[model samples]
Target: MKLHIVPARTGFQWVKLGAKTFFRQPLAMGGLFFMFMAAVSVLSLIPLLGTLISLALVPAATLGLMAASREAEQGRFPMPTLLVTAFRSGPANTRSILVLGAMYAAALMLVFGVGALLAPDVPAIEMPEGEVSPERVRAMFNNPGLWVALVLYVPVLMAFWHAPALVHWYGVSPFKSLFFSLMACWANKGAMLLYSLGWMAVIMMAGVVMNLLAVLLGGAALLNIVLYPMVLLLAAMFHTSIWFTVRDSFVTQEDRAA
Candidate 1:
């Protein structure tokens, strides 16, 4: 597939487009997002491997959301089953996303593995096995493991950023999709930089607004209680923005289909 070379300013437009798309189908999109999060949360509850499985499913879930966005664009409500479009499309599509998921899981595992290796003696909570205490959490932040994991996750993020869309939309293979996604990001790094900065600006503005509300209401607890929906809204928009970025990176739907 031929990648589109959009201007650096295009990133902002993608956010705008994402917002428009999300608003057009807010109920459907919101429900789908809730379902997605619920699924992830449930999967992450497993004893040891749950988190990895949840991470692996992320790409597939993301592709499903992209499909939902397309449906919303067509003025149709996205169905709950849209979450599994990647898996149900056909063997080829299923294989591509599954492989991508495996790679993502492996990469994340590698990141944590390296982190453990780097800080084998990192202390744990001195409590029940399944219960995490505040001291343990604080200690983890002061340890090397967190930083190592964060540093190692960058390449993994880059590799999987646009991979799901590439596979679902353009029928790209798993490994090639990773390469193309990386190249596409590198090529459009300037736009993405702007995009990231824009997100930070929005987040800052949200914080400002939250603080203002807290002060005006004379109770930070009140705003804290009410701000959850707003945060979820911003999160939905961010996920939608990811779809827009992927859409703009490739040829038009008709051309890509051909």
Candidate 2:
């Protein structure tokens, strides 16, 4: 596959195309995403190692969703089995993806470690044996540790943004995928800037709408009932956007059609 230097406006089109793909097979797409979440949740049940494994599987999971999007874009229902495309594509592709996943998991753990180093031992949560008291929960948000994690995550995110797509679709090796992905992102800096700003605007609008709903409905508690599903839909759309990023940045339209 070849990299395409799309104009700045092309960035906005990813989310637009993503919305169109989502509407095309909402049920199938939603079901598959929820299944993915459930699978991750199940994996997370395995104790400390479970969380690591879940993070590692991220790239593979993302590619599976992209594969599903391809089917949805073609007017076909995305089957659950499509999730294994990365694993079964070819031996080299499978190995490369697995290596990428392992690298992701390692990078995440390193980020968490750095956060711990940057944060001071300020406070601890205490309450019932099973859960933190409500006050403690609020205190955690005010803790500096949270900001440390958030700050360190930005660059980690930038590095992996296109790595999975490169490995899965372009047959790049694990280390090379990271470099090429970063370079591709750097090359499309203007478009990515617009894309980021556009999403921020949408997020602001969503927050405004949610708050208005809470006010009209007389309680923030009940608003969550409506907001949760909306959040999930937005999350799905974001993944769809990632798929389109891969398409627009790597494949020509005519090639994508074939």
Candidate 3:
């Protein structure tokens, strides 16, 4: 497969395509997303190995969502089994995906560890009257560890962005997939940045609209009731867009054959 650089504007197009495609099969896409979350949640409830296993399954789960997105884009109903696409591909590919997952988990742990070591200790906040003050909230946001973690996650995101698809479609090994994924993201960083910013704007707009409704409806409880599902839907839409990023950024041999 060959990496292709996309124009920055293509990021906005990806957002549009993802939202449009999601509407075409809202129930199926949304249900699959729910199933995805359920599976992760259940796995995470296990013992000590739970978190590790869940983290290890991330690449495969991500691949499944991408596959579902592809199916939905083609006007097909995506099955829950699509979530297992990575594991079912073949022994070699499955093992590679598993390795990729392990690598991702390890990378995340390392980043978290370093961030924790570098972060200053936050003083405990006193919650008088059983309510957190705005200062407490601000202190939470001001924690350097949180910022460090977010910053460190960027490279991990770049490395894994397309690694599963690369392995699935091109039979790239786990390490090579990470390298290629990183290169592809770096080569198309402008588009990626725009894509990220576009999503943030979409989410912010959603929050604003939801907040307005909460004001009209007269409660924070109503906001919570509506916001949870909306957040899930937006998350599903974002994951759905990931497939488009791969489609536009890479050229497989079959693409040339066509």
The segments of candidate 2 whose C-alpha lies over 4 angstroms from its true place after superposition are 124-148, 252-258
Q: How close is candidate 3 to the true structure, as a TM-score?
A: 0.94
Q: Estimate each model's TM-score.
A: 0.85, 0.86, 0.94
Q: lDDT tens string, model 3, 1-258? A: 788888989989889889988898888889888887888789888875887788888899899989999999998999889989998867998889989999988998888888888777777877866476998888778778879898999989999999999989888989998999999999998888889999999999999999999999976878879988999999999988899999999986788799
lDDT (Cα, tens digit) per residue for candidate 1, span 89-157: 789899889889989988988898888887757544569764668888778787787798998887678
What does candidate 2's lDDT look like per residue over 88-191, in tens digits?
88788988988999999999998888777766676665565645477776667776867888877766777788888788777778898888777778888888
| Span of ten consecutive residues with least summed lDDT in model 2 | 123-132
Q: Superposing all C-alpha atoms, what RMSD in Å does each candidate have to the true structure?
A: 3.9, 3.4, 1.8
Ranking by TM-score: 3, 2, 1
Error of 3 at 225 (Å): 0.8
TM-score: which is higher, 1 or 2? 2
Clashes in each model (backbone N, CA, C under 3 Å)? 0, 0, 0
Which ten contiguous residues of candidate 3 have the minimum total lDDT? 123-132
